[model samples]
Target: MKILITGANGLLGQKLVGLLAEKEVEIIATGKGNSRLPNPDTFTYVTMDICNANEVMETIKTHQPDVIVNTAAMTQVDQCETEKEACWDLNVNAVEHLIKASEANNAFLLHLSTDFIFDGADGPYDEEASANPLSYYGESKLAAEELLQKSNIRWAIARTVLVYGIAHDMSRSNIILWVKNSIEQGKDLKIVDDQWRTPTLAEDLAMGCWLIAEKQAEGVFNISGKDLLTPYDMAMMTCDYFQLDKSYIEKVDGSIFQQTAKRPAKTGFNINKAREILGYEPHSFEEGIKILHEQISAQ
Candidate 1:
């Protein structure tokens, strides 16, 4: 099988590339600029911008991949709020471009969406949950999902939450890494307790996408960690995993931080659909931390 991944430089994109390397399928990894993958020679790497309509069309046409996994997006909520046009271009418009390309190439399009689509009023949402996005980032993602929903192409939406993991050649930090590093440096951190999420490990999310691709699954599926936790909970767990000082971690609420984007108070996914249909299972948050530790230690 031939699979092309967008945003190959990002965390989820890099994880997907690494995961796909072990499989028998052929990979075409595409990013906006020079590939940041540790082993770019392992597979086909292309510098194709998803935001460019002509480029997207030409690249997909040239590759004619059996599956197109789009991991690219302007995911920063505040950034999206500040730069609405760029956000919509990458999130929604680029999706339309991919949809058109997929129609032309007859490829199954697997899109990576966020849990932000739902308001925090009530969470641990199923695939059938009604969406009421509170932020521009969420709105952009939802618009992309709606495009796919209304399109006549083969597509699947893999919605995830608070994805955290290590990636090759990446200086980017997630909650786990941030907590560990901060505690090691003896820096006190204020973490929000009011907000909740099922923080997904990047590898688990990659696996979920792979399952959808392998099955050519249609419609939406929640692919995230089973645990529903807050930032404070995650910090405590991180401390436990690393045997660090918990006194440095302060539990706070959302109002403390002044941010451009409004965060959902509670938004996690219910992965029952994915578990039942795709046989998907994810690691516990502690187990996920252990995995990160192994990677960091090896590095």
Candidate 2:
């Protein structure tokens, strides 16, 4: 099988490439520019912008891939609030272009989404729950989902949360990295005690994506981690796991920090859909942190 992955240098995309490298499939990876990742000899790279519909179509036509996994997005929550047009263009418009290209090339498209679509009014949302996005970033992702549903193409949407792990050449700035950096630098870390999510490890999420692609599972699926915790709780756990000073971590309410984007108070998701359909059993938050610590130690 010939597979093409967008955003190949990203946290999740790089992990996916590593996982798929052992398989018999031929992989063609692409990013916004000339960013390259450490990979096996079998893999190939292309630098193409997804926003250019004509260029995207031409590339898809040339590659003739059987599957296209799209992980590209403007995921900065605060930035999306101010740069609404750019956010929509990258998240929504670019996805539409990819969907059209996938249809033309007769390829199955697996698009990565986020758990931010929930308003946080509810504690934990299932796949059947309706999306009520609180931020422009979430709204743009939801709009992309709507477009995918309307298009006459083979597609699957995976909604994930708090993804963190090793990347190829790009720097990842997730909650895990922030806490690690603070502890390593002997600096105090202030984390929000109210905001909650099921922090997923990028490696586990990559495996789940491969399963979904292999099964050709269509429709929406919540592929988040099993455990849920607030940012403060996650920081404490990370400190404990790494044998760092707990005094360096402090808890702060979400309202204390003013931001352009409104974060969901409790946006944890229930991954029963993934568990039942894809047989996906994600690691707990503690296990994820332990793995992260080990990966960091290796570097």
Candidate 3:
């Protein structure tokens, strides 16, 4: 199997590249910048920006990979709200480019989406849940999903939630990392108690994508962590895991902070379909933290 991974420098993309390379597959890792992978020789690296349609098409044509796993996107929620055009270009237009090229190349596309497609009025969303985005980031992702559906190509949407893990030269910090850092520094933290999510481990998300590609599964699937937790709950767990003082953590609602984007009150995922069909099993939030801690310690 030949696989082309976009955003290969990203958290999930890196995980996919690492895991898929171990399988009987030829991996082509593409991203906008230079590769940050441990050893560049592990896989073929191509500098292709998802936002550039010409570049995307050229890369797809050149590789002609069997599967195109697109993980590139403007994922910052507040940034997306402020820079709506950039968000749409990356999340929507870039996906359209991939869809067109994938169809031409006859490559199955396993695209990563977010649980934010829901309005969060009701949580733990399944594959059948209607998309009602509360923020621009969600709107962009939902639009991208629509593009895939409208296309005439074999595609699968793996909707994940609150993906957290260690990565190779990660630009952004996840909730677990942030909480652990704050606790380690003895900094006072005010975590939101209102928002709920089934925070996914990055490795689990990568595995879910690989399963979809390997099984040639189509349509939508909710791929996320099993436990539903609020940010406060995760913070407490991080504190517990690191043996740090939890007294510095304060539980607060969404109203305490003034942000650019409106957050969904609750947007966890119901991943029973993934479990039943793909035989997907995800780590618990605590287990994920433990894994991250181990990885950090080893480094």
The top-ranked prediction according to TM-score is: 1
- Please give each candidate's TM-score: 0.99, 0.96, 0.98
lDDT of 3: 0.91
Per-residue CA lDDT of candidate 3, range 49-128, in tens?
89898888988998899999999989999999989898999999999999989988999999999988899999978899
**Candidate 2 structure quality by residue, lDDT tens digits, 107-126:** 99999998888899986888
> Which stretches of candidate 1 lie above 4 Å from their native place?
none
lDDT of each: 0.94, 0.87, 0.91
Task: Give the poorly placed runs of model 2, Cα more than 4 Å off.
Answer: none
Among all windows of ten consecutive residues in candidate 1, which has the lowest summed lDDT?
Answer: 164-173
User: Which pairs of residues collide in model 2?
Assistant: none
Give the Å error, residue 96, model 3: 0.8
Which model, 2 or 3, shows the larger TM-score? 3
Reference-based TM-score, model 2:
0.96
lDDT per residue as tens, model 1, 1-299: 99999998999999999999999989999999998888766789999989899999999999999999999999999999999999999999999999999999999999999999999999979999999999999999999999999999999999999999998865689999899889899899999999999999999999999999989999999999999999999999999888999999999999999999999999999999999999999999999999999999899
